[model samples]
Target: MPDPSLMEQLRADLTTARKDRDKLRTTTLSTFLSEVKNREIEQGRAVSDDDVRGLLTTAIKRRREASEQMRAGSRAELAEKEDQEAALLQAYLPPALGEDEVVAMIRDAVAGGASDVGGVMKAVMPHTRGRFDGKELNRLVREALAG
Candidate 1:
């Protein structure tokens, strides 16, 4: 059987959240679904699962940044809210690779003749994309190349 689209999954989850009276989850999922719909309208077509994943990734990143800024400003309550929202959004993302796993992948790329940082990143990104943070991967690649 074909996989259900990401939007369908999100809508199903939204319904469940509403039924459970999970206000935070219901709000987050609804807002995200609206964003996805807007993007679809812009493109005049249904977006792929990858596109939905990208949108989720962006939302999570924004929440993380806002959480950090709020913490820095000593607003613990607001920071906590952002953290919760980010966690909710992250539930839809693919699990991230561990540091050791990422390091191993970088080593393999370097061994495969990716000598410079840029070359290693280019080699590793395709394997790591959506499963790892680019900044963390870049740092690991640099350390692997330098060592």
Candidate 2:
């Protein structure tokens, strides 16, 4: 489980988000917390830090996909809204790994004979989950494999 202090901070942020009338953020975070609670209940234990991070990563990925689709559909306003929600969601994440870092990790995976996309992804993903978007990381890994 995450430290009590970390969960407290999340609770405080949820309150702040609500008070600030950030509807998208408020909704997204509420749903996130709810999901965490649900999973915790399912497991009969408090949610671990990794579990919370994974949930946040999933939420972020979904928002990113919606944002992309919105843009592709000529719905710039909706895309911008999704982008804002994404940024708000990201506020809770650890610092993202840089391109150099990602590339170096992928290189290490390759050196370990993770030349196939699945192998490389499985090897490198644990390092970035919750801190980096998976699809973006996958794209980078594909580029690394090709090169």
Candidate 3:
């Protein structure tokens, strides 16, 4: 299970969001917490810190995909909202690896027998863990491999 303190922090954020009258922020945070609650109930167990991080990653990915689709459909307002929500959600996540650092990591992965894309991902993913988006990493890996 996640550290009790971490869950407490999430609750604190939810309360702050509500108090700030940031409807979008409040809704996004509430939805995230709801998901965590549902998972805990369905599994008959509390979520681990890793599990929560994974869930956040999933939520962020979904929002990013939705934002892309909304943009393509010319739903600028909706897309903007999704983007804002995404930013807020990301704040709770670990700091992301910068492009240069990612490239360096990829290079190290390649040195560790990551000739194939899958191999590279396997090598590097553990290092990233709760930080950085997998899709973004994949793209960078592919580019690094191709060049």
Tell how far residue 69 is off in model 2, in angstroms: 2.6
lDDT of 1: 0.87
Global CA lDDT computed for model 3:
0.87
TM-score (C-alpha) between model 2 and the true structure: 0.77
TM-score against truth, every candidate:
0.88, 0.77, 0.83
Model 3 agreement with the true structure over 47-111: per-residue lDDT tens digits: 88777887887888888899999999999999989888888878877898887888899999998
The segments of candidate 3 whose C-alpha lies over 4 angstroms from its true place after superposition are 1-4
**Model 1, residue 108: what's the lDDT?**
85
Tens digit of per-residue lDDT, candidate 1, span 1-147: 887887788999999999999998999899889999999999999999888988998888898999999999999999999899989888887788789898988888878888899898998887777678888888888788778
Highest lDDT against the true fold, candidate: 1
Give Cα distance to truth, residue 82, candidate 1, Å.
0.9
The lDDT, on a scale of 0 to 1, for candidate 2 is 0.84
Cα lDDT tens digits for candidate 2, 47-75: 87778878777878888899999999999
- Which pairs clash in model 2? none
- What is the number of backbone collisions in each predicted candidate, taken in the order shown? 0, 0, 0
